[model samples]
Target chain A: MKIFGINLAGPVREEVERFLASNGLKLEKDVEYTAVAVCREEIVGTCSFAGNVVKCFAVRPDWQGAGIAAQLLTHISDILFSKGITETFIFTKPENGQLFSGLGYRSVAATPQVILLEGGTANIGRYINEMVREAGINGTEKAAIVMNCNPFTLGHRYLIETAARENEQVIVFVVEENRSCFSFTQRLNLVRQGTADLTNVIVIPGGRYIISANTFPTYFLKDRQISVYQELDALIFARYLAPAFNIRIRYVGTEPHCQVTNNYVEALQKILPSYGVKVCLVERVKSKGECISASRVRQLYEKCHWEELRDLLPPCTYDFLRNYPNPGSQANQAD
Target chain B: MDIKHPAKAGSLESNDIYVMVEPSSEEGIVLELDSIVMRQFGRHIEAAIKETVTKLGIDNIRIVAKDRGALDFTIKARVETAVKRALEE
Candidate 1:
């Protein structure tokens, strides 16, 4: 059997669809990398990926138990590996979980109908273990804070400071996904500058393994499906990430404006402790009883509300905002 | 290579190359290249495409290649595939 890449938007996609339909599976709309296993000019098996997660995997009943599925998976995995995606997740039926388990995937979470399996040379478990080992800290009380810090406002600083004060050390994982108005480098730099004085805090990139775009695409979408994204994100963090960091507490700011954030906090509150990761919601930093937020700062910048924006940001962030070029008028100097 | 029709191949994903080919009344191959590594590998990529199309023995065509750091083999393969698809009757 020969495995070849097929574009979902191309003519060959119909063959893939027919193959999937024959196996009682439907096409997953978001799939990107799709490979069809062809034998004697007939499509015998198919697999697809959405980010690092494998979806819509199917093999013809006649082709099953003959190693076609394994071949297909290996082919797709090679492609993903070449692109620097080492870790991968898959959602499959519970009965088929045993099959994947034999292929190096370990079951992380499961329900009667569906099971989530993660595997790779650098899976989350190994990655965190390595990071912790390199850190050389044992039995030190640690708290975790995952922040986007789109522009690193005072609100974020307040949350991190609170976490730092409560624990011996705070591990600050800045989300590495570049979906914000500021680039990842810019955001990371802003957070670094904003938190430079927090001697007890360790800043690190969250990589693509944490609340990444791969795991939580909807979170970065302009119109978010907040509840669904929140539940899934909270589950991944509580089940995998928090433990990896050896964090007993995850500190977040209470959301006064964004109902979506409040809902996420609620989900974290319900789920984190169940997995031994405590959720702490610190009251947000406020100016005149108004919660300080990155989005608010962006809005104020766009409106040229420098005075209010300055109030909402820390000195470092305020400086960055002041110097950030205005997209509306390219020629005008940032005031 | 000579283009008998308009066709396309490849994807815009990282480490992939997208090629769009169409019939051109112009006498020789007109190649347009856009790549993230245009400053570094741009000349090499163009040379690969030119070699592949010349080996295919078609002269009059239009080629638009959007590259995302594809390897030399990938560039050649994608260009050949696109040329063949465009030459299809």
Candidate 2:
């Protein structure tokens, strides 16, 4: 599918299409790579030098302008130098080949920048989905996700919105614990009640602490807990949903606030690519420069400064706050 | 340091294993060996250490690594982690 192209490189037409389909590349024509590239774990500025001809070298859009490809090209050049190959050649579209020229790889012609590495490079780069899913979804209909609506803020809302737009059915995961500023039934009720208007969205309980303390504790340092949870949910989701449905994407917010999570993300990026799961990092839902945070909203509600909370939450979240205590109210703890 | 400098110090880890920070002055660090493994590619490990240390902003600390069978990367990771932790502290 065109969607998640960088990650899946889905089906093509004719014999290639047949091979892709057989190989499990479920291309979505309308699906965009923008999301996939943003979720990409790690695709450093990638540059290549070759066997036949180094005709192509390009960095993903998200990674472009970071000089990532140039550096990568240089790294490979260093490798080539060790092997006694001082002169290297690159070919690509005239404009695109400038990148190679910039990196000291002379441009002989506007051709393909494909490379022939010294020892055959491994064809280990498999589409992430092919390895993960046994049966792939080729259509628009997809299943919904059930996730924790911990404190109910804008970040949570965006994840749901992203999934809802893509999937035919949406299942929201609300922590079925009462101690969540709004109780269990109340939290479920709140998420359920808030998305009630959206025909496709459904609300449900995220089982007990199965996901609690599930990921490494270091992830806790992230500004948003969901950032770390995104990877966790994606792994679980891919392992389970890929067979039943075309579970293509997992929406998560960028942890602009958490470098610790960013560090772990470095590894997740490397690992997830192996599984065909592209991790998306959505921009935070914000009022101004600051994202609407649950902690901030809860603080406002507790201080009885309810009005200021609106800037940070959707109207439904505020209305839920107005009712104040709901969800399995008597049963949960705030841990 | 405000500038990329070297550090030289002698830290002994247990007996029979001593570490030194060569050029114990500028942006370089040298690890001298006084143990048995010091001869078995110990110099290569120390060179890697200097490269890693310099990149890590270590200026004048020579570490006498009494490697009790620590892999190169492990030594790198542990030492870097220690150095990073120390610097952060």
Candidate 3:
């Protein structure tokens, strides 16, 4: 058998789709690289990696236990290492957990239908421990909030303020993924600046564990799969993140616009409670009888509506926007 | 010797082992090993890895080994290859 890389488009793509479909799997659109093992020009096994997360693994039943899967995985790992990505994650079915476990993949979280596994240089335990150490977390009744905060807005500030007032300590995790309009560093800095006044609030990077491309690949996914990914993401938060920081309550702004955010909030509500964490839905703050949102702020900024944008954002965010050169051109540019 | 970058060698197959080596922030060698025969030969495999790394004079590194019943010689070779690759400029 020969294992080689295959482009995601063309005849090879069709063969992979057919092979995966025959094995009760569908190709996710986010796959960046794929490798297939072929025997006599027939696809025997395949694996793929997208942004450090590995998925869409299928080995023909007749070829199972022939070490084709291991070979495919090694190919993917080589590609990832060449790209300088040390951390890797995989989403697979529950039954195949042992197979991957033997290959050095450790279980991060698992549900009935799907299981999240991670390998390579970094793992969740070490990540959380490092974060806890750096943040200087104390044994207080802590609450949690995870937000992308594309640009820190008044709405986000309000949600954080409410959590800070209610809980003894509020751990705000700024999403570390750089897929937003603002870069991760800019977003993280804006959050730290915005919440600098709250004595009990500690802002930290969400790292690769929270709402990342690996944990929640919300873009270009079917509606059903979005819910599954959301649940998996939520389970990671509940089972690992919350307990590590002693966070008993999670605060989220009620989503009235984005269906994806609504589903995520619903998933959090459904999963966190069973894990001894309560979900608090804070009514979104409004400006002039309209709900204030980051997307709205982006729109106003794009339109150069400084007067309107001024009221929607906090002073820190507004100042940052005013000083930012050509903010609109930076939209959708990943850092 | 120092591991300047994260590097890996070998494959996850029967009678083989996968070795990953990276520079560690702290001193000393940090090893994480998983083997099918861990209950039987875990100590022997660990000794092989340590001996190979020590011979290479790598003092501060992190090694992750997933063994599928590889012999001591195979383990040493994979570890040596991975450490050397990591040391490459």
Candidate 4:
């Protein structure tokens, strides 16, 4: 059998579809590149990758024991590695997990039936290293704070300022996923402007590794498996990302209202210390004895509580709230 | 002893290993080992697999070990299970 790369078009696409269909799988439209293992010029096995994620991987039953799957994976990973995409993910049944694991993929997340395996040795480590190099910082007392900052509020600013005061350098990883009411770009701009006075605080996109859909699925929505995902995300941060940056401390605002956020902090506490990263929860900034939270700002926006929102947010956030129409109004309108 | 049928044990879970055992007509044990810790402890891991196979008295079989940083005990237990399952009457 021989392996060759094929574009997702024409006779090769049809052969790929038939190969996948034979194995009770279907060719995914989202795959960017695919490699096929051919025997007698017929596709016996197929593997596809979209960016770093492996999709539509299958081998015919007759060719399963011939190591065709491994060949296909090696081909795809070689191409991905050449393109500078080392960290990859693959989804497959629990039974075929050994086939992938034999090729250096480690299980990251799993259900009873399906398992998600990461195909790189140091994915998070590479990301943190790249982030540090890009920022060009080399300080022993570096700390970090990961925040969504739907809209940067005084509480968020207070956390950053506190971190900046305690550490020589503070890396603020704004969650880059655009799943909130405000887009990621908007949240990032608000965070930058809100903390412009803090010289030690360096803001950067968290990319797809921090609180990512693969690592932390329930960032905005609540789910039964929220705690599980939270622990995994925290573990990734404490064990890999933190050390790559020489981060000694992680600052998080205490969550008096959100159980999900509080649970996440608890998970961080359970794992971070073992990895030599201290978890610090600065109390949320309060106004008139009420804790300030981004949720409260979102709630105020829904109620058009401009006066109350002004009390909770910093001047920049207040100005953004005043000028940008309330997201609630936009949501209320027919699409 | 010879593996009468193909069988698998353990998982590809983090810090775990998966072992697949199949019947083979070869004269001696044939083992294919892969691991995340292959660079650091490949020899030790292979020795553990061979030791387990020897202790189980299974000499003629094809064993595939997909390791994800499992400890010695886990490796032994999984190898034992796969061999036993493959040799089931």
Candidate 5:
């Protein structure tokens, strides 16, 4: 048997899809690199990776014990190392946990349907330890909020304010993935500036462990699988993040329009409480009977309606938008 | 020797080891070793790694070694190669 890398396009892509289907797996659309193990000129094992996360891994039933999966993983690791990605993650079925653990991957979090694991140079412990050291979080009655804040809005400030008022310390995790209109750095800065008045609030990047491409690839998953991923994401927060920071409550704004956000809130509600962390869903702050949302701010900014946006956004966000070069054109392409 | 970039050598096959070396903010060497035979040969394997890194005149680096029952010579060679590759960049 020989293992080699293959571009996931043309005839090779079709063969991989057929191979994965026979093994009860589907090809995730986000996979960037694929490698296959061929025995007797037929595909026996396959693995694919997108960024640092591995997906669509499988081996023929007869070839399972022959070390085919290990060979494919070695090939993928070489590719990842070449690209300077030392931390690797995999989301797989619960039963395959042992198989990966033997290959030096440690389990991060797991739900009934899916499990998350990490390997290579970085792990969740280091990520959490570094954050804890930097943030100096020692209090026990702290609350947490995770936000994308495509651009910080007045509604975000309100939720953070409510959490700050109720808890001894409030940790605001700005989603670090750059899939939104505003980059992660921009969103993080806006959240930091917008909540500067809340002395108890601490804003930091959510890192790869939370709502990131590795943890929750919402853009590539189906509707049913989305909720499972949401549960897995929430489990990580409840299990690792909350305990490390001594966070007891999580604050979220009530979703009025987006079904995905609502599902995330539902997942947090279902999982966090059992871990002793309460989920507090604050009502969305409204302006003139309409709820203030980041999307609304984005719409007005795209139309260059500063008069309307002045009410929806905080002073920092409004000033940033006013000085931003070609704001309307950039806002039009936002997710 | 200074590790200018993160680099790795070797593979995860049986009787093989994967070694990764990168620059660290903290002083001295930070080594994390995971061997299948860690219970019996963990200290010996760690000694082989530190001896190799020290011989190379490297002072501050972080190394992650995942061993699948590799021998001492194999570990030393992989560590030296990974450190060299890290410094070359």
Candidate 6:
């Protein structure tokens, strides 16, 4: 019988329950994999674990070759991982060797009725890079790249490259906690990784002050900061970042990518002039007769338009898109 | 909560910055509470004062706060009472 739903009164239920009892395995509560799979009206296999690891997984003898075992093992392992069972196992009859070979049940020292399932942790390094107090750039012509870059396309690279050529230093201050698709740090790192070759560009966390504080202006709490505190902050960036390094210019893209950021550039252009910082607004980097903006790139990403993106992005950026598990994500966040 | 108390009279410590009531600095007088508050709360106190100074204004004089763990509210009240005493001057 093809393994399917779990009906309590059916032959499969009794056998599954018997199998559970025989193996001394019990189901867990509130685990998505356990709850979802256990309640399924169709169940072709059985697996159980007590603590945070899977004890065993067995597809019905008749349904073994169809890869039902792999499905069950994946579901069961997913549950065990949630329960802190980083190592999982399976126990089964040795006579059915062929079915086990192709299935995910990697055979470890197996007894007559047991097979150990390998619980593996794939590439899952998700921690933020440690921010060392000393590792960042000290001073130079502190050029800040005010861009959403959305996902840091080739056009962004072209603009950044041009900015680097004309200035002694550059810092890309990413907007934090944006509701856009890629997060602040994600977008920041994309720029960092993409721009690693540029000797002068530094990535600084702008916090939300410049980003969302303007959106809801009332709660900035540092109200007087508008005059003195921010003046002091800008002074800190000036006194410490510029003189410490020798920064004199800031490079930004010309308008119309995001209307919100257009206003941002206009304001910075006015205030920055007094601080002896000149703003450089570069023309939009274009590919195949179209201007490369986050919005246009996002639309292409969502539609998986790789060919169009190829012409729009630089070679390094094109590689990032090509290597990205999912490309053509229609998204833009640097407003 | 009303926290009015008998104003303590003592000599203002030297090396500690102080001021006599003057007409010019009346718009605002931001004192560095760093010497008093620095050992305990450090930088967090600077932020607490911005909040404190805004609510109390520059009326409060002789703010000799021996701040250990005083929050924004305490700083405001202490400075307000200190100014209230100088108002009698």
Best by DockQ: 3
Q: How does model 4 score by TM-score?
A: 0.58
Ranking by DockQ: 3, 5, 4, 1, 2, 6
- lDDT score for residue B89 of model 3: 92
lDDT of 3 by residue, A1-335 (tens): 89999978767999998998999887788789889999999999999888988888999999998888788888888889889987898877789998898887888888787788887776687778878888988878799999889899999999999999998999999998877889989999999999999999999999778873223663326435777777888999998898889999999999788787888888998999999999999999999999998889988888678899988998999999888876563652432
For model 5, how does the per-residue alpha-carbon lDDT over B1-89 read when each residue is reduced to its tens digit? 67999999888888888898889877898888878788999999999999999999999999988888899899999999999999893
Model 2 per-residue lDDT tens digits across residues A231-309: 4434444444433344444445555776644554553454445656565566767776777666667666666565677
Per-residue alpha-carbon lDDT of candidate 4 for residues A165-270, written as tens digits (9 for 90 to 100): 9888899989986768888999999999988889988898887567632234321133266666666677777766787778899998987878878888888899
**Lowest lDDT block of 10, candidate 2 chain A:** A118-127
Candidate 2: where are CA atoms >4 Å away? A1-147, A176-179, A208-234, A241-246, A259-273, A325-335, B1-89
* Candidate 4 chain A, run of 10 with poorest lDDT: A213-222
Q: Cα lDDT for residue A70, model 2?
A: 36
How well does candidate 6 score on lDDT at residue A78?
A: 43
Candidate 5, pairs of clashing residues? none
**Candidate 1 wrong stretches, greater than 4 Å:** A14-32, A39-44, A60-66, A92-96, A111-114, A134-138, A212-236, A239-245, A256-260, A302-304, A322-326, A329-335, B1-89
lDDT of 6 by residue, A1-335 (tens): 23233444446555565555554533323112332133245445675554433433555455545545545544454445435444333333456443443332334433333332323321011101112132365533466665665677877888888978876777666655455666676677787888898988776665422332122221122232222222323433333333433457767676555654565565556555676777678888767777887778777777777788777765655676666655334232221
Candidate 2 DockQ category?
incorrect
Candidate 5: which stretches are off by over 4 Å?
A: A136-140, A212-215, A218-220, A302-306, A323-335
Q: List the residue pairs that clash in candidate 4.
A: none
User: TM-score per candidate, in order?
Assistant: 0.65, 0.37, 0.90, 0.58, 0.90, 0.41
- Model 6 chain A, TM-score vs. native: 0.47
As for candidate 1, its clashing pairs are B1-B58, B2-B58
Q: Higher TM-score: candidate 2 or 4?
A: 4
Interface RMSD of 3: 1.2
Q: What tens digits encode model 5's per-residue C-alpha lDDT throughout A81-170?
A: 888889999888789998887776788998898888888887797788788888887756789999889899999999999999998889
Off by over 4 Å in 4: A1-87, A90-97, A103-123, A212-215, A218-223, A325-335, B1-89
The TM-score of candidate 1 is: 0.65
Candidate 1 residue A143 Cα shift, in angstroms, is 1.9
